[model samples]
Target: MNTRVNETERKRIAAAISVWENEGGAPGQDSMHHQYGRRIEADHSWTIYHVFTGVPARFGGDAMTGLSRMDATSGMLRLNLRNAERRRERIELSSFRAVPELAECGS
Candidate 1:
């Protein structure tokens, strides 16, 4: 089944979890881990996944493009940072163990 919603509508859902705080929306929060996934085109898309609820949400992306005059929302899946090291345990590379700190403050 293909779940689809207008991008504008999807943005409203994304705005809730969006890192960027808006006028009236839930501010972003620190997560044990992040989740990501994308569905077929013309379908509901979300990058954030709630493990407990079993529902996913979009991470949201750049509002606009300067060159193309186009708007882009985040569709790319993000690996959850929580237990990130454990996830990389299988890999031998030491660099994968490093997790970047969030530089932004949530409202």
Candidate 2:
């Protein structure tokens, strides 16, 4: 399906993602949220893989307004998946912000 979100919904989702990240992600972690999204790889891991905002209809209205939404997020999931030395090294050398070597999901 092609269910895109609006700017308002984007901000809302960003806030929700921030809350989730605050509770689970490590303290003082380097991320694209802090950086200006110069590092695509790093940003991708957080904005795409770790969070649910990347998913459609996970929050806000899903064909209806004023309805509660369910989130399917596994905070820090990728960090555990990519436990390889080389992967970590690549992310580190990326500059701007190093992307976490996010591991795969098991479902």
TM-score of every model versus the real structure: 0.19, 0.20
Clashing residue pairs for model 2:
42-99, 78-102, 78-103, 81-103, 82-103
- Model 2: runs farther than 4 Å from truth? 1-5, 25-107
C-alpha lDDT of residue 27 in model 1? 21
Native-structure RMSD, model 1: 16.0
Model 1 scores a C-alpha lDDT of: 0.35
Candidate 1 on 29-74: residue-level lDDT in tens?
6343333322222333222334355344433443211211011223
Q: How many pairs collide in each candidate, listed in order?
A: 6, 5
Instruction: Estimate, for each residue in 1-107, the C-alpha lDDT of model 2 and write its tens digit.
Output: 23455777888989887665534444344443321111112223222232333332222323111222222223123333333444557766564243344332211
